[model samples]
Target: MLDLRSVEIGYGIMDHARNQGYATETVGALIDWAFAFASVEQIHAECLVTNLPSISVLEKVGMRKTKEVDDRIKWILKRNSVNEA
Candidate 1:
């Protein structure tokens, strides 16, 4: 099974490596890796309600908003829902 039970991506502008598509690339790779395992039925992500950028990234990677609890917005990428685009 895929080992990434949880994952988070962040931007570090101070290192001069920010906003260069790093976050998107990394998240895409992570998602691909997670799906590589046949036993991995789903992948999940969460972000604060105010984190627009994080929400955008999750959307770009084809994760759908499943639910919201408290201040967090939960997203889900289902293995069987590969048609999302």
Candidate 2:
């Protein structure tokens, strides 16, 4: 799920469909849509530290790692800091 000030988007794909780049594509597309239409200044995501694939997806979608607390890592994609593909 991605959360901004007052808007949030969430998704879940079955285990069998994991790790095929589907999450990355979905996240990227959503980010694009959000930045284009939403009033939020940044998008945020949280993932378990052990979830490498999820981490990759966040980075691929232009979210930078900002901080970590215990087993979770926090990521943020700012409107002005988006990395163009």
lDDT digits (tens) for residues 1-85 of candidate 1:
2355444333322347655777677778887887787767778788889977778878888889988999999888887775656
Quote each prediction's TM-score: 0.77, 0.80
lDDT agreement with native, every candidate: 0.73, 0.78
Judging by lDDT against the true structure, name the best candidate: 2
List, residue by residue over 8-77, the lDDT tens digit for candidate 2: 4456668999979899889988888878865777877888999888888887878888899999888877
Once all C-alphas are superposed, what RMSD does model 1 give against the true structure? 4.0
**Native-referenced Cα lDDT, model 1:** 0.73
TM-score, structure 1 vs. true: 0.77
Candidate 1 deviant stretches above 4 angstroms: 1-16
Model 2, total clashes: 0
